[model samples]
Target: MLTENESIIRFFKELGLEVTSIDLGIASEQERSSTIQISRDSYPGVEPHLVTIADIARWFPELTSSGDIRLKQPQPDVSNCESLDIYRQYWEQLLSVTDIIMGFLKEYRTRFSRGEYPTTSWAHYFMNWTHETWDSRRLEPAPIDSWICYVDPSIRPHIRELNEFGLITRESCSGHPDDHPAREPFWPYVMFEERAYPGISAHLFTLADMACWIPTYGRHGFDVSLEIPRDVELTRGNIESYWNQLISSTRQLMPLLEDYISTSGVDFYTNMSNPSLFRMPANFQCKDMSTTGDFSR
Candidate 1:
């Protein structure tokens, strides 16, 4: 299925409209997604359709056009009180407005970070770049590669246990510590061997596939995102009780990871060739909690 943004861009082509992402790198999430430039593709002389939320909302106001106002959510006013539900809006109708509004907000934030807002009080604000770790979706240039690896003292036993289970351990961290070097992720993670393709390392990938079936991995709130080529650098996530989460997942899921030995029924990860598979989606690690280790997730 086409994503909302992709589908809109596709329709834009039919209508002789076009969208493209451009860089004016005062970093914002928009650079990773959303259309920055939209223009008329067929008519070279026509001006770009630099539409905004107010404009688009006007274009599609039939639902709001003298219809049941109760269908929409009301803007709050003060009795020092409550809100009246206007119209219970529809998803598809709102999505078009959402894309344009999101792009607008992205630019607004980027400009604010750049201190371009016209307000004296804003003069005090400056670009606040902090140390951030982007997700590692790569299998190469791993920081370490060895069967004998040093992990957090708490995670060491778990590591040894997994290694003995035949999932070759590559790298792991037990999340933030008091003396945290600041380079490591704030969440705990394990990097195990995965088959780049069917060969000696195939079992590792098979085990990884089995891990996907362990219901406890998610039910217990273990926010572990699994990226293929399983690089330790970036395919990481944050968690509460991170070590306990790691230990519990190992203890509870081991039997399950081990039981599914036969590859006959397995769905081996099929998109190992895509480079993006090696990297977690943007802001995935930045999230405080997330979904499972399935490469598809």
Candidate 2:
């Protein structure tokens, strides 16, 4: 375990090779008050009670191991309303600050591994790119209700109707529909549905087999819009390299993730313990304090 300040410093030092001085400078400008405000916004009804680093260390002693702070009893004077309110405010503020700190840390780790500080937000950009790629790659309009299933010899008669309706196109070729000019057979529209019982024997179709049949009979030309960038192609050799970098960055940020999960867990447990935290219908039973009979015993 480490002190809050020590943890913060260690995070920066570990990523010093990838982080710019300007990044650190910008992060330092985040004020304690702003963090508190954000926390209040996050949990609307709950008042924050303690926000300082020392207070956090006292409450969550697992964060530090210099001494056993967890053994100390937290004695609050309930008579002083002002003191209680102040404490709540500080606690809320600390939550917000910690969130911001973790976010920055994740961003730094991702950017470092990627070898670029994305000008736009990386998450938003990735989502948009994926959507665009999907749109460009889709050759034909999708059916309203498409499903895949196995094709039994008995179901061939029913499938003929599907073929007549132009729902499925079949072809024969071994290469990708977009890249291979070979007349590969595939069936995109024909979906195989499974029978609930083995005795039912409904026709089963694997995705590859379905794809093989599509180009053989399907109506549209191949769509090559989802082509990868020349520099970013996912070749067999480079795919693992990309994954390795991602895993490394994630491992480095595990501590922050653990802290966030622990904090949230504490909040959830606290809320569950307080029956007054929720407003229930009069007829509803409060399960937390319920004395229901146990059938297992």
Q: Of the candidates shown, which would achieve the greatest TM-score relative to the real structure? A: 1
Model 2 misplaced stretches (Cα beyond 4 Å): 1-35, 38-231, 259-297
lDDT of 1 at 128: 16
Write candidate 2's Cα lDDT for 29-110 as tens digits.
3311111111211111111111222223233211111111111113334454354454455444444444443443343334
Residues 1-297, candidate 1, lDDT per residue (tens digit)? 986556656654544445452222213532221112343222221120121221233211101111100111112232322211211122233345545434323322343343332111100111011101112122332332354455665556666766555445556665545325656444455655432111112122222332321111211221222322222333224333333444444454334323233331222233322212112233322211112122222
TM-score of 2: 0.22
State the displacement of the C-alpha of residue 181, model 1, in Å, after optimal TM-score superposition.
Answer: 5.1
| Candidate-wise lDDT, in order | 0.31, 0.26
Q: Which ten residues in a row have the lowest lDDT in candidate 1?
A: 119-128
